[model samples]
Target: MQACRSAGLARGLGAVTLPWLWGSCRRSLSLVCAGSAPRAGDWRPSAGLGSRARRLSLSAATIVNSAPRPLQPYLRLMRLDKPIGTWLLYLPCTWSISLAAEPGCFPDWYMLSLFGTGAVLMRGAGCTINDMWDRDYDKKVARTANRPIAAGDISTLQSFVFLGGQLTLALGVLLCLNYYSIALGASSLLLVITYPLMKRITYWPQLVLGLTFNWGALLGWSAIKGSCDPSVCLPLYFSGIMWTLIYDTIYAHQDKRDDALIGLKSTALRFSENTKQWLSGFSLAMLGALGLVGVTCEQTLPYYTALAAVGAHLTRQIHTLDIHRPEDCWDKFASNRTLGLILFLGIVLGNLWKEKKTEETKKTIGSRLEN
Candidate 1:
């Protein structure tokens, strides 16, 4: 009878506590989704990942959390939990490499592999650098305050040490490329090293990020041709910058309201009420630059078809944009991954079509010679 009474008491307590616990969880989720900072002791979640979660139903953090406690902070620091930035950085490289394919051939698979691996290391390094520069600022931002460095899960010295390690690994990747490409890749570091400071000095920091993020457009072509000529990749590079301006602007809005409170700079805060118009202007510029890429590379109809798709996607993103809603901005920003994939596919298919025409011409010449 005593044992039964103890079980009954535990059941009664659980019934009383469960609803309150659920309520807290709901409140917490709301605050997180709304970009509101949680109290110091509360669990902090990642922002801009609701769409990612709904799609993958899992995240790097969830998987890394299952690992040993010692590794969780580092993995988050590298943004292994958020792979979108890596994808964004890498796709431009693929687009450049693929666009520069030998007439009727795929881009160098070996070079693509090198660039892909390099992108992972370099993007992580970039994030580490950004975190290091922004740790103090991060502490003041709702979405970023719990970042590994800002939360005191990792130290500044450790982050710099870690940054050094990433740069060393990236150097090894750079050594695999030809001298011109190596030099080009190395020069990009100037932009990377300086990008973090742009937010403090200019509302157009997204422009600086564009310059940094899109270096792969030049690097990709130079790796294949052993030279980066202005005539060949300038258009591609410009297109990438315009594209970055569009997506990064959307990304900036997520932080704009907070940035105003903190006096940080961004295109979102700069464009304010006229974002859709500015995005439209950027879109036209990107499309025009992409058309130049087709002309310079002599890409075929399939390439334009894919470009058309890219255009439609960008249009839809702009049309649906609700600048006041951070969640809406995040969804639009995340959609750029799909845009990158589409553009890559377009480049690949255009080359395949060129290859087919080349084969057809060769076959016809052989028949004539036989006759």
Candidate 2:
């Protein structure tokens, strides 16, 4: 009699409990489903998907974002909204300019200004080309799926035309320089053209990016000197490449899962578990190259000091890197801007040191003559 009552009580409890549990699950499922309901003519990616969705704004607050709706597409196509890539592209040029200068002298500020303009134009053009080449592939990567071309916000032909305009402006910047620099600058196009394809074929696309992006190091030296000696410019170029390797690897980590899903490859995948080790190697290579660059350029102790500062910054990044977290990787990648500025300032200080030494030498010579 007791057993029968206990069973009856348990059945009554389940009868009451099942409906509530079912209702709760329905509500939870509906909440998850609400964000992805189909809409007519909607091509925008779901807000809940992907690392970029979590980390970056759905739309960047750029000049393009602020523009009239009709004109917004073109500016975004140029990526005027995000300036980090522009800085990364331009810094190598300044590095070369600073290093190529005679001891104790200012870098070519005029040329720096010109390279800045050129970097803006050329980076836009490169983005255009990358989009055009990867539009189909881009639509598959959640982070890039809404890229103007990939989202049908900009057509391929229109992108090509915009690319032409950017190239024309870049050419104008090139004309402001000498023929040697023009020739050197023109060679970079080959790298830009091939870069989008690199990810398809090799896990080392970032390596190609290192070579392509750092061409400015070579161009900067040639712009001033009309030619580059292997010894003088090579170290800067190599260091820039190593720097790219470090940062781009971090960037690749942000999209590693997506890349894997879609048959793409990156260093992020290749060094998945051992990322810090790889970053350590790249960082060492970059710093070692900078040290060699200092030796080759006859930079003083301050140059190495500045290089040490860069190393410390990279060390912190590597130490703090949470490779699995998209936000952290993006932050580390963005931190390269600070790294670039530090190195630039270091070069300036090293030159000041050289200038002081020159002044001391002149004073010693004058005193001896007077005696």
Candidate 3:
């Protein structure tokens, strides 16, 4: 009976291995593993496998895996495999830029692209800085145990050097803005450098993160308009901070157990059982501040609609969240990117609506005068 099972396994492999190999090599082999074996001379995989190969190749993990060995560790160090952080950092910039656009125009595409580039660099730098500081702590956390620095794949000295390169590149991007923006962007460095340490000393590290991560909300408007309008930029910035508090708290829950074991602190540990209540408060404050932004900017109905959508999304997130489950926490944290995009779209549409109203008002006044 054992011999018969072995023979069947070998036969199954003979039928399936060839097509799988061909697909991997040429991206054009069909997998027909369940069918009877084809005659050796006539066997050929179908082209359906190419689609699967294309999708696999497009994934960030695949790209990182395919990279040269020496570069792979650094790539992972930058968290390129996880782009949600980049989105979270960049979305506020998009919001501010869209809101700051001239009354009749779209946001500046060039500035958007430039800020996007800066977001990637600065976020990478922030990660590198964080890893360097927390490498010891990370080695004990299951989620972070395999991180490049914590796993000894990269030395602290090497990470520090890489961090310098990332910051230098980030500074180049900052220089592309006006003098005030450059000065404003430079001021954020202290926050970035210090944020990782907050986790060690206090439970409110996520608060410090909010301050660091949302600097772009202030910088984005100044980058385009040459300066910030406090009424618009301030409330927008506050709303972003509250938004960050919501998501990062959810994220911290993933490590709460490990953090407790290691004597590290986080909002997850700080809020413990009352996390839902705190999240609700933060959500309400975020919505209130966003509402203020709309009022001050004279945003249209579409903007208010988007805010309502955002409110519903957050309410669902908080209500459904299970803090004890790491996977659930991660999913909730990841979903904030969608929340960010919703608000950004709202701001863009709000600006367009305002522009349309202005055009109609001008036509009305001109026709009345001519009559």
Candidates in order: C-alpha RMSD to true structure: 16.0, 21.9, 15.7
Let me know the TM-score candidate 2 reaches against the reference structure: 0.82
Per candidate, the number of residue pairs that clash is: 0, 0, 0
lDDT of 3 by residue, 1-371 (tens): 23533553454454342212111100011211111111111233444854542222344455556789999889789876565677788778888887887654566666766777787788889999999989999999888999999999999999989999999998988998999999999999999999999988999998999999899889999998899899999998898899889999999999998999998899999999999999999999999999999999889988999999999999999999999999889878877866877887888778778868987898999999999
Off by over 4 Å in 1: 1-58, 363-371
Q: Tens-digit lDDT track for model 1 on 69-135?
A: 9988987898766656766787788888888776666556666656766877888899999999999
- Show pairs that collide, candidate 3: none
Give the best candidate by lDDT. 3
Scored against the true structure, residue 163 in model 2 reaches a CA lDDT of 90
RMSD of 3: 15.7
Against the reference, the lDDT scores of all candidates come to 0.79, 0.76, 0.79
- The candidate, 1 or 3, that scores higher on TM-score is 3
What TM-score does each of the candidates earn?
0.83, 0.82, 0.85
| Candidate 3 Cα misplacement greater than 4 A, ranges | 1-57
After TM-score superposition, the amount by which residue 175's alpha carbon in candidate 1 deviates from its true location, in angstroms, is 0.5
